[model samples]
Target: MREDLTEQLSPAQIIERAEMSKAFRDVFALAGGKRVLFWMLEQCAIYTDAYTGENNSTNYALGLQSAGRKLIAKLDEIDPQFYPELLLAMKEIREADKAAAKSLAEKLEPEDDADIA
Candidate 1:
């Protein structure tokens, strides 16, 4: 049974299924491994400073994000799995939202007498 299950599941299929999962989809959809790790690090600093009563300044925030991006770049060079989906998701989400909004507006107003301003 174990052998049959192993034979049935290719590693790529397993990875894709895991990536498409509701919880993990956001992770894979965001960026690749190193970037994902860097985001986790940033979130940790935010929460940790909040708990420790450290003053969070604009400079500090900028520094943190800069560090994150730098780390992501370095990690990508070293490990080569950095996939950024933020821009792609931005386009997709905006298109989806536009379609939904258009549908709603049409439902609210008839085409012949609608004020399209």
Candidate 2:
């Protein structure tokens, strides 16, 4: 009979391992499990700061493009289906943020003199 190693870990321990482990490929493999995938999706869904009302999608994308490249690669190896879906979701958030920022900029722009005549 095989004993489950993860079963021996407390919730905090598991989270700590996930966040701090140097073996990210192994961690990503574990995270690719169905339940863990849902958890990761939930975390990735937070593309903005709720209290600050700040859009962080661009930052997230940059991180993924740079510092997170290894994580992305691991994700691709672990769960190929999720990689494109994650990119699509982030892209949607970024486009929405851009549109909102443009609308706000237009609103804040001074009216033309012709309009005041």
Each prediction's whole-model lDDT (CA): 0.54, 0.57
Output the worst ten-in-a-row residue range by lDDT, candidate 1. Answer: 44-53
Question: Which pairs clash in the backbone of model 1?
Answer: none
Query: TM-score of predicted model 1?
Result: 0.34
Angstrom error of the Cα, residue 86, model 1: value is 3.5
lDDT per residue for candidate 2 within 1-117, as digits (tens), equals 113777898999878766654454444344244335434544554333334334585666544345345555566654576567655555655678799999999999998989776
lDDT of 1 by residue, 1-117 (tens): 746765799999767645544444345445353245545655635324333245566557656666656655644443354324433544566678799999998899847645665
Clashes of each: 0, 0
Point out where model 1 deviates above 4 Å: 1-26, 29-57, 67-82, 110-117
